[model samples]
Target: MHPDVAVDILKKAETSLVSYRDTGFADAQTSAKEICEEMNVEAALKQKRLRTTKRQFSYEAPDEPITDALKKMEFSFFNVVVDMAIESLRERTGMMSDVAKKFSVLISFSSELEKQAKDLCNTLTSGDHSDLNYDELIVEMQSFPKQWPKQNMTKLDLVFLEEKGLKEIYPNMWVALRIAVTTPVSVVSAERSFSKL
Candidate 1:
């Protein structure tokens, strides 16, 4: 999947999880209530503090309505789950950004993205690795975009270059695009972007 596509997926996932979770909890609560009613018993809920400090006393909670108890359950369980999912998505968003930073060079060069290209080069060359030439990459980045038949293209797909026959003339871009294309990717935003591709 494209980094942008993957990022787009993660971007909206938190909202979707939040939006849908409430309905899911409501449905589950209703189902549980039905089960409890079929058993012919009153719904019951009580609470007690689990711990007490040396100078502290635990408080016993009075009986509460089932609805209140369920709400508490949602806050303790479902809310935590949703929060964890959101946090995981946030981490993945950062990862997708890093992937995009490395692959930004694969897109048509822009004055703004030049820094990313340089950074990518520095990263690839760091710690006794020198597979890429910074100067050559810079030259190629500036000149390579002109080869495109359309200068205004959005979301460049490197696979299309298969027919362009310009790899030798723009080896650095070829390498960068190859890396980007080969990078592992995922999900709906990715699904949509690849469909567009």
Candidate 2:
């Protein structure tokens, strides 16, 4: 793998975590340059070990060029780092993250996110006995940004403060958030528990 590709993967892995989002995660140029420094340390160690050894060089085979050895080491490091980055991205974006990305409408909404919200609604309503109404949900979702009142509305309790709750106000969103987003995990697991393995 190319060092640039490895650095890009590392950047993706680093930014995938919410904690590292604001840290810049060490730029690609710096990370690529780090390989040479690591190679220097590795070379010094090899030289020190050779000095203490009693083995002599063989005439049958030629010694590999230092540049070739460095290139090999650099490529090896790139492959390993890229693999590690892929694993980290997979591990971090778990089932819950998938659900969150799908139902992010609960947290915030914008013109850009409308398509995602519509798709989420469509996917939710595609199944049998789905509680969401795609057409209504799409219309409501389009207008939600205007009525959002955007007061860090992560919790649903505040919206449910009234006697009738959000259902009476934004019926589609209420169903989308409450029924689809909240029930998918437990509902699927519960249904599967009774099925044959």
Candidate 3:
């Protein structure tokens, strides 16, 4: 299942709890206490089943402990969320450091791209710019969250840098940003392709 779907399910479950708290049940005449008790039991059973299914599908090795598998699964889910946030250029609220670390991981995944990014950083730091200064571009990128009020810049923004006239202003930085946004980390499509093989 997609992580988005899982998140949706969890959100719905939370909303249901809120609704249950606000209005005990649809029928006011009925015994709300008994009904809630029964619903709680049912919810517990469903949660158990869901956990069992997740454990079964997340099997890593023959001798691997379930706790270890669960830990790995949690990390993978967190990584996916981080990747989605970074690609979409979401504000990420207070996760700037974490996002930057994940961005580093994503860039490091490709040695060629990592080399290019390093080269661009070097060129900028070496003061060899013909138009835009490297320090200025780095400052702009770092302060993007504050500069853009809505913080709605997406991967498409990086793709069409000329629309915002950013290419001419931050050429090297724009290229590196484009590469970061365009890199594909998810293997869902690749897995699907291999399924038919």
Query: Pairs clashing in candidate 3?
Result: none
Ranking by lDDT: 1, 2, 3
lDDT of 2 by residue, 35-153 (tens): 76877643222322223345578777655444543345445664456557556655534544556566666556655566776667666764565666666766776665465546645
* TM-scores of all candidate predictions against the true structure: 0.69, 0.41, 0.28
Candidate 1 lDDT, tens digit per residue, 1-197?
Answer: 57877787878986788776768787777777798899986656566445433444458755444456567888889889878887888888887888776766566565666687778877667588765777788887676556653543433455565667877877776776676665666534655455322
Which one wins by lDDT: 1 or 3? 1
Model 2 Cα RMSD, 1 decimal? 11.8
Candidate 1 TM-score, true structure as reference: 0.69
Which 10 consecutive positions of candidate 2 have the poorest summed lDDT?
A: 42-51
Best by lDDT: 1
lDDT tens per residue, model 3, 64-182: 43354334443455445544544433222223323333334212333354443444465334355543344554554543433432243444444455677767655655665554454
Ranking of all candidate structures by their TM-score, best first: 1, 2, 3
Best by TM-score: 1
